[model samples]
Target chain A: MYRLFILAKCDLGYAEEVGEKVSELEDVSEVYSVTGEYDLLIKVNFDDLQSISDFVQDRLHRVPHLKETQTMMSFRVYGEDIGDFVN
Target chain B: MYRLFILAKCDLGYAEEVGEKVSELEDVSEVYSVTGEYDLLIKVNFDDLQSISDFVQDRLHRVPHLKETQTMMSFRVYGEDIGDFVN
Candidate 1:
């Protein structure tokens, strides 16, 4: 799987709405409203780079209230603690 | 709960080892080795800002092989998909 970390800047007071929409998109795993240069942090996983490209250009780009985005590709997942939320 | 995203840079070939140690720390939820300016992306949650400060200064600082880190505080969790893995 190919994973990407996307930092999104949204219109003022629109982060929650933008995040909700982004999170519903295919491949989006998590979306958080954050305080910094960007308003949201999004995690997405896809089968290939082509799918990622399509999602970014065709789907993510269509999400309203999003002003800008910066994407970082994840090369590997070294550790994940699912037990934190699971029994 | 307060959440933080940490961007870490590690010494050559030490990301996995550093990530393993970081993941074992209390509050660390995820660690991903990624491309671009930072080597790893870490998600952590704590009860307050003081706890986050202590974790960064006392615990995360002691993780060997980690060169530097940049932390971003999360304001809210707009959306999450645990079902992707839980099912």
Candidate 2:
């Protein structure tokens, strides 16, 4: 699985609702309402790069009120808790 | 809590060792070995932005063989999975 983190900006007061909508989307593993330059953070898993492109560009970006998205493709994970992984 | 995702590029062939060292750091939530421009992905939780800055610059960046890092800060969590939360 590919781990992708998307930083998103949303319309004022729409973060919570946007998060709800985003979570329901296919391949969306996690989404968060956050503080910073971006208002929401999305985590997605896909089978390949093409799958990510289709999901983000063709589908995710179509969601209303999310103003912008910056995608960061992960190369590897270092500190994932072994205990957490076990559970 | 503040959520941060860090994309890291490392020297060739050092990913597994780097992952082990990173997992031992304080406030580090998770890390994954991934594929892309970067070699590892790091997730960290800090009390505030200042803590993030300190940890990334003063502590994390010091890990050997990991060449560079880019950070993304998150304000809130949207779809972190109720079941995951419940667990």
Candidate 3:
């Protein structure tokens, strides 16, 4: 599987809403409303690069109030917590 | 000191230029032209939280082509290479 981080911008006051919608998508593993340059940070796991690219270009870009997006392909993830244990 | 991660978006094709200007800022430690929902990822160090916020709200937001930004204040950063040994 491929792990990708998507940094997306939402219209002011829509960060939480965008995060929730992206989280509910089939291949999105996790999403967070974070601070800094972008409003939302999304973690996605996909079968291949094409799947990720397709989702970003087709579905995500169509979301209302979403202004722009940046995608970071993770070659190696060495952070302490990859994802929060939400159980 | 505080280390901050800012995810910011630039108008298409301006990522590299914005990255350069941001890198030239007094306290900016590093800046990267990254892909995903946001166009840029910047690592900034400041003497205090006020400095960081002030830079973001006052200076960064004024950059002509900048669209938006989200900031993630690092409580603990555990990556292998904190900063590229740019030597």
Instruction: Please give the fraction of native interface contacts (Cα pairs under 8 Å between A and B) kept by each candidate.
Output: 0.78, 0.77, 0.11
Tens digits of lDDT, candidate 1, B9-83: 999898889988998888887788777899999988777778888899999989999999988998676665464
- After superposition, which runs of candidate 3 have C-alpha atoms over 4 Å from their true positions? A79-87, B1-71, B74-87
- By descending lDDT, how would the candidates be arranged? 1, 2, 3
* lDDT (10s digit) by residue, model 2, range B1-87: 677777788889898988889889988867777655777767777777778889988899899998888787766666554533311
TM-score of chain A of each: 0.87, 0.86, 0.82
Over the stretch A2-87, how does candidate 2's per-residue lDDT look in tens digits?
66788788888888888889988988877866555787767787678778888888889999888888787765555444443311
Taking chain B only, the TM-score of every model is 0.86, 0.87, 0.81
Task: Write candidate 3's Cα lDDT for A1-87 as tens digits.
Answer: 556777789998887677666767777754555556777766666667778778888888877788888778754222122232310
lDDT of 2: 0.75
Give the distance in Å from residue B34's predicted Cα in candidate 3 to where it truly belongs: 8.0
List DockQ for all candidates.
Answer: 0.57, 0.47, 0.09
Question: Interface RMSD values for the candidates, listed in order?
Answer: 4.4, 4.2, 11.1
Give candidate 2's fnat, 2 decimals. Answer: 0.77
| Candidate 1's DockQ | 0.57
The worst-scoring run of ten residues by lDDT in candidate 3 chain B lies at B78-87
How do the residues A1-87 of candidate 1 rate in per-residue lDDT, one tens digit apiece?
A: 777999999999898899899989977877888777899998887777878888999999899999999889986766554542321
